[model samples]
Target: MIRTDDTRYALRPGVTCLTVPGGAVLLNPPHNEKLAGLTPAQSQALKTLNQGPATASALAAESDSVTTLLDRLAGAGWLEVTVRDGDRDLYTLRPFSTPPARPSTGDGPRTVLSKFTVIHRDPDGLVLEHPTSWCDFRVHDPRLLALAAGADPTELGLPESLSARIAADLRWGGFTADPAAEDLDFTTRSWSAPDLWFHRRSTLGSRTVTWDNFGPTAWAKDEFPQRPAHRPAYPGAPIALTAPDLGALRATDPALTAVLEDRRSCRSFDDARPITLTQLAELLYRSARTRSVETSPDGAELPSRPYPSGGGVHELELYPVVRTVEGLAAGMYHYDSFEHALRLVAPADSIAVQRLLRTTTATLANGAEPQLLLLISARAGRVMWSYKSVAYANILKHVGVLMQTLYLTATAMRLGVVAQGFSDTAAFTAATGADELEECNVGSMILGTPGDRPRTTD
Candidate 1:
């Protein structure tokens, strides 16, 4: 059966099937992986499948060719049995568009979201990308995300037009029907894994850094990369900043050189003696406190921090989970750069807060607790708004700067410090009440009294 122009056919999302001379080629663009070429007979079967769904009985009645062709392609998820009303079923190919979230027949079947489906929301809009779709569906419909999070699309009460658009997006973008059937154990990690999943031309998915997707072919897009306008300073943190003085601003060769040499990774910490509040204040004032807040060309207020950033966007924000800071109770506090003070995020000793501290300790010190742990979160909006390809990476580099800054500062003050590369990222977001996609823990570090320190001569 051939589908008309208005009729939606199941074209495999992200995988492109080309009808070539001797055989048909099936290419999975998202992974840059290709299936074995199909012979002319097999290609005809795929072509028929792409055109429209057919039943084994119907195909068998037409000719044994259809059944034989389908039999070859049926293994390994290439085809699925879709049941209709009265329990009638059709043998369908891998991908078929139109209401990709569910079946076309009313009262036929309600579709569910795939566990692998990642929902990302930006100022631009919501983008839903499943593993199958090597690209993103830029959803303009506001109700879509809310709908996606809730029940099946059929029960959402979405307007006819919006519903139709969503169905089209699901069909075209490669979201699966009945996402619950698949064993998504792998996606549990890959779904929120730190990596760029969406790009033009090149394949998407995987936990590899975004840069890995970059290839000569990826650069051949129609439009060149335009540096986006810098995002405004992180909002809602205290506007007032504190500027504590570090006595004697000395930056000479040997003094600076010694401090630099002193910078070392300290795994052991003096848990008995907690860091004084004065030390925390001084550290913030010198290392991360905002020096100047100025308006950018886009009129967005940008902050200048102690460390350098790619676009001066200062996308990094510090959240210190205090285990034992003098005069400060145990809790998670957002370091208000402008105010130069700690803004209470979660009450002291909250379960979420303790879990984060404990988790960080596990990640950084083999379950040993520290006096202070700084969770470095990136305001991705600020970076992605100003830059393209290198946005997430710049945040990572900024984390490096923050790490070095903390390392040297800790050394100068005779405090122990170390940076940890891993964390329960999803848990971090939950504890901090941060949006998983927008604000994330890019890196983490610990600060406390030096457990092992010795005098050194240069």
Candidate 2:
């Protein structure tokens, strides 16, 4: 059995004890309101926590009055408890996001590690963390780490005392799974670990867990300088695109309802009557062109486009990989939305480019190949520069918005368009000579002349 006397307690990380005119106020901003009205003795006791963890017996010996306050704070999760053996700390239960509910008492079912639990190195040597967990366990002992890593006490041949201690720590951290809960719910059973983790972190579920650092925090500005308004212009002779007259098109364009109803994923294309360069230019202009560039209050350039993006961080860039078009050469060209032009990145017959097109053709599952394959990439740093955890999720959302915009626009122009659900980053990187981390493809779509009888796969 684990000894309670060996447990040492301290204030949770990020919690501060303030000296007020009365007793003292415990301030954990964004998590709790000021916990005011404490006696001088209680405040003094809480202050001693800053020095480090102390046992209840030790604290009680110093001042008997401090015991009640310590127990209250520990129960409320304002205090973190560490199990110690001499100088070595076995493990520490640190409250991170929410006020932790006390672990269940008494022996329960046979335990297995939760599938969602992850052990990663942070400032602390190795931390056992879960996205939906109210607290994280800072593991110091290898024995405990092994237990968290899915070692059974019997298999590890750990001493009974040490095994019991590790098991208690595991219970406190909720590292074990609840098979009953998992088996009972269909939705719970269906969720993969990564999807559940992503869903939990990207959206705010609880005020106690999630901080108010949402939207345009500019979290990375200090570490990395803000990226320029536009990516550096691609090398090669730029292809000047035709900017269609908005006034003329406004009077002649299809109605919104007609375009919406006509929108479908068209897999078949007419190679005989391929889309002309002028038509391609109009499509790009109408769907993805930068209307105007303006500076944010924080001095970052925000480009307004036909589609909406999170924090106006228009990170998405277009590269049209062409196979056949009446007026344009067969090549992969970067769409310069700001300048309304294209810069050739790769030849049409390049092995890498052809491989990417071939993959899409196979994915399309039709006899036809894409006449014009548009690869949509994201300058991830643009959004990451401003936002924190939600950067990638926001990028995916932007991709979806742009896809819909492309769909409607292509439908109006009576062109065949099909949004591909998957893309090959390696093929794209090889074709464009771009770093995957710096700028990688997030989405892809195929566009061409609508066949006499277009095959729809909506």
Candidate 3:
């Protein structure tokens, strides 16, 4: 709600003006909106504003057409508005999406801070942000911050008119709300602010203010290069996994329908005859081995595997924490999907590995640690490099798909398989000595030779 007589305007950051065949086009990055097919005069006016902030009166002599163009651009949220007093600054309104509707004059509704409004330090400075807000406030004056903090004009010893204007602008910007008219519907009531905030930010909609792979855009890669397709094999003696024979399996393996029906989460493992290395190798080969690697147009290596992954970016890696495997000594081993091999990560008696196994055992009433505790870790940057907002959601989805693949494969092999409901990422980081942000456990499962006891759901 900028005053026409006292406000200054400037082009919003990340906006680029490009000359076209007939005119010029104004591009807004990290958003889908753009001002395409602009006239030459409109471009010139934008260039003038690009030089720095200038009042409408200062640009009035250019032409009547330029003034109208400037007004249109300002209304379109392409220009940031700053309310000034004398030569000193007040505050600036930076629009991340479409600008909020203008505030109505005269006595307005009583307003309080919006529940979703969050004040934090960004790359710029301390600022106010609402999860679904169209614009945010950049406080240049401490008085403005005070108003946001719910201080009265008299408490700050400020002029009533100035405070009123700032308050009206804040209310209109969606940072403040009328308590009587606040949304308290069933959905809003059921959701916490952070949960709702995460939901809105992760999924794409007309209200999305951040960038994503909407058009399968690789904007993230343009800024930061994508991480390598495969994490370098861990330094150790690589044990090659035995790739199962499909031709022989056609005659020997159980039917797919029977396998699906027989898939039960078995908590008890046959400790007397623990799972062998060959069996573990075959299971990994059938479920998680990388089939082939393809290159994207942008030269990124996209690997194909037994399970479907978002964008064929198989960022999930498997680590088998062996406690009772027959041939494979009690140790944590990284399953090199690309090489169809296991690389030792930690030795038989590693503290972190033992703690992970002990925790698994404690979850079951009368069960020992499974012969194999396969931890599925995700390389976050792999998916994040090519996508935004949906990176984490996609990773979780990949874990589910991979889990199903493992379950069915294990069932067919007549082995015990159970997907763990939770995993301690901190313990996992301790075991692998990897950055939690870079690589962390998203899912885990237990696999071993099923015990003779009757299968009962735990």
Candidate 4:
């Protein structure tokens, strides 16, 4: 949850709402407006009721005469009886607390200590206890604590006695642990390129025990592939296209032109009609498979195509999530652009395809069963071999360019196209079998027949 200076609460993306104290309840009139006249006694009663539900007799003890004030506040539209328990009138505060303040920190901080677990393990086996949730220890920093309390830890730093006292207070206050040795076993493992360490501890009877220093080891060196063993093997048969296809695609219909001109990012799709295999084949051929090859004067090979890729590396590969395409079984298939055919990776009904597509925002906006989805992945080292830090950006640019081509082509072919930016990168890489390579997800585009025309801001 990100907090703002104004004390407004934001729990997650697109979810912003007012937060009140635990016991306090919010009350607002049918229409929002200021309460015209609220007496001091009435206001005090409301504040007291905010602590918890209370009867007039209970409220009267906390504040002034509850009956007179409660009646006045209710008449003034400042308070409402939220619930009735026995004879007590539970009044809710009329206006909610102000929006939370903007958070001073953005993106917050990375976890310093992670996956902390207490385990009782003997040579025989191990039993895991409650896993410690990652907590920010920076709050225990003397400097920060002092600042929070409107004092200066720095000034006290020179005085050893005062500093020790403050440290003691902080330790006992649950902000930090008391200075002691903790007994722990450190285990490290490699996840992706980074090595992760897990700290294990066991309590023996009641005696306090501690281990020496325990922390993550220096990051292990990344072992990247020297070269990619796999190469695109061109198909023996020529990718076929017909004259009627070109004519039908070239026809100028506003909707069709919008599809062509609209490029990628079609949020609304028509699910009534099934996308034909011919249309799917056309899209796959244009975006995934190579259209033509060119040779330089020196005899170096080049691709003649609709997209501009860095160094003509053609690092991008397509994985299709086939949901409701005619003549195609539902499954997760890797488009063998070289073979010009779909290689079944997992059954369409298999959870693997659902899991992979679930990682994408497209699945949320459009239903999980879109007509077709194109998962674009890149061979990292393939592009990185020619480009360095810029490789990441270059590969993404290549995806964008290719998506534009795909969108335009889909539009011309009277199909819906949506480019999705939000996806679970790690999941995508794993599903596409590109996680091992420096390979990463470039982007994803969902296509189907156009449904309802989307409402446009422009």
Candidate 5:
């Protein structure tokens, strides 16, 4: 199980290591794994391994602890034993964790591809999709699907190239993925963190779709998909059917109902007529300002805002990138909901701040650049600390609710507001100087004085 002189290796895709001034580090980026820091010798060994796999002796020439370091990386789901040049076998690093080599059988029932993977239809007819990793590959011939659906490839007369590729993927654990793959009895196969990670990512993000779809925005393909007997929960835990039993859904004011129907999305804003500081404060107070603060027996303080959040955690924070807000200099400010004030963070001209603004302006490509932008972020630990199972999905739900609140509040105040489809997450993190793992930009919105009124009546 250890590397020997006869061994050789090839670095798997996305496995990289570098010696930094602070320290040496390796990353398998597909899973966003920021692994433990490496030592000087360990970095050298990785550089050597990148060429191909080498025996322990070859690696130790760089440092005495090279083998130990390699072993540690392997423990972190980075290594797999493979043959190179048909002469020697050594380990390789991969972004994902590898399971045990595979189960050997005593010559009994049969073998089939793991149910965790699927053969499904796409624009290209049929494809092999790894449920755990969202790694998909196209199939040239439609007949290959039968083999992919547990039929023996040999009996199906599948194309030779297709058969070979399928076999390779199977042997590589691409088909029978670890962690979430089920046994013949349909019980989960692995319990390790990596295994569970693959399980959660695939199942929660892409395997199923919701009517509202506050989860991941991708899905696996299935031909003639049947509705499952059970579906993923759209809402969590106790039902909160807590809305008031007001007669029928009706807006009493004819003008307010007209406002609801006439609301328009303003893609362009007027830079000449900047929004007043008082207007900005009123908007925040109505949409996101804290009305009350309460501390749980566990000592976690919860705050109230116009938008409803799961468990009143209020994990979302707003970073306003102001290009032209009256009485406020062009800069980045963090909205302190409790203080009902903007905490000055950085000037608008700084490189990181400029990058975020420019990137967002390009992303919004709606004719004109925004003067007032809001970067909505979520505190991962605060939200996930309480709801481990449904943390991210509900965070997205909270994002939707808060976004609607901003939209409505902006509409009432006669300011333009529109949420971007996406934003540069890395840029936002740097702009805000936040720990990438602890806080992340979930969504973004732009607002300012409108260029011209579209309409306010249905």
Candidate 6:
């Protein structure tokens, strides 16, 4: 018998035994091996026997009178039984011991200290360096100490006597020890040395003042206070371009009113059920695509829609990740709004769909996947070349209008809807193959069957 901590044992050919805590042993049988000699009743009885020690009467009761074969096997010496008090079955087997301990190295104490070095310095005295760690130390000339104290030295917590000493020395003469000293040491010995003195220039000549002892009396009160609070002044006059409240606009336009009343962020969805192809077509047609073409006197064509864009560019493009839409393959498809059709872009597995949706939004409940995921991208350069700031703001406003349209349509159809804006922008851009020019992601939406609707109260 092998006796060691964390040891492996072969129970049979290609089979092994694993010992766990509390002296419990687990038999891991091989795929090809089977208990060929034992009958079904005997096999079931053995399984019960291995659970714990038990008397013959107790074993029969527990195994439903299936222990007759167990007694026969024990008489044949194939199985060893040990009798104990009170209702426990015991099996005799060889015992094992614990392993020995290993030696260890006994090294003395150690510590880690942070370090910093000056990397660059400008003529204006602005210094830049990559510190090993951030510290609460001020870097300033000694002459400025007195002025800094008057402002708010309580925040810095340096003693008043130290500030006065630095001010008197720097303003009157300068550093007394050596004017050419480049490296200043501030160790415990140097701080306590009697040689440390301040040299000053009087009207007569130079003079020196010596102190009995000079070092930090106690730990400097280094709990620096935060800066005073401030609040920006409010503008006295009204500003233009502020968004109108949705409730106010709803009273005039019935379409906008429908959207404002029905919009909600839904999560739970019905898995087996999905939206029909006809419903998908209607959603795409209403939110995007050209419903009717209008011709100008100069023969210029324009799409009839409420969503406004800069110079009627209509640069937003849509991509759909279809997982459970009826009559549609489970994969990614680009929505050609102009053509009013879905063009198959690539085949995506369930894992890929989960990854894409997780990066963009929260997971759907009950492992319920979305029927359709909409990706909106903007052709920025097309609009930016003609209109600058107007193009940027117009693109975002168009997305908002599109979301409202989707919400109202989904509500009318009794379907779930969600708009997600927090996404891995770079990953989505790469996956869509829309990186030509400056294509930017605008928004995303998930649509599926609504599981349960909350009851309305009067």
- Could you tell me how far off, in angstroms, the CA of residue 154 lies in candidate 2 after the best superposition? 6.0
Off by over 4 Å in 5: 1-256, 363-367, 453-458
Q: What residue pairs clash in candidate 1, if any at all?
A: 10-96, 10-97, 240-338, 240-339, 241-338, 241-339, 242-339
TM-score attained by model 6: 0.41
Off by over 4 Å in 6: 1-259, 292-302, 350-354, 360-363, 366-368, 453-458
lDDT of 6 by residue, 52-138 (tens): 434454444234334445433332223323322122211121111111121122442221111222213334242212121111112
lDDT of 1 by residue, 194-219 (tens): 34243321342232224543322223
lDDT of 4 by residue, 1-458 (tens): 10111111111111122223322223332223333344555455456555554555445433444455555434433342332223322111221112222223234222111222232343323322222211112121224334333343335443454344333323322233211222132221222111111211122111112121111111111444333323443234332432135355455435645654455456566667878767788887765566666654533344545578766667777777877787777776666665567666666656557776565543435444567777887776666654533455667788888888787777666687777766566666545555546667668877888777672321
My TM-score estimates for the predictions, one after another, are 0.50, 0.87, 0.74, 0.45, 0.49, 0.41
For model 1, the superposed segments whose C-alpha errors exceed 4 Å read 1-247, 251-254, 363-366, 452-458
For 292-409, candidate 2 gives per-residue lDDT tens digits of 9999776778899999988787999999998898899998999999999999999888999888888786645465678899999999988989886688899999999999999998
- Best by TM-score, which number? 2
Instruction: Using TM-score as the measure, name the better of candidate 3 and candidate 4.
Output: 3
Best by lDDT: 2
Between candidates 2 and 5, name the one with more favorable TM-score.
2
Question: For residues 1-458, what per-residue lDDT tens digits would candidate 3 score against the true structure?
Answer: 33454677887776766655445566775543445565666666666676777776665525666677776777777778887765667777787567645767667676777767777777777777667777778877676667666775445555666667677677768788765556755654566667666666677754454454442456677688888888987897788777779789889999889988888888877889988998998899889888899997878999999899888878999999998888878899999988999999988788888888877875443857778899999998888877767778889889999999999999998898888888777778999999889999999899888888777653
Clashing pairs in 6: 53-88, 53-89, 54-88, 54-89
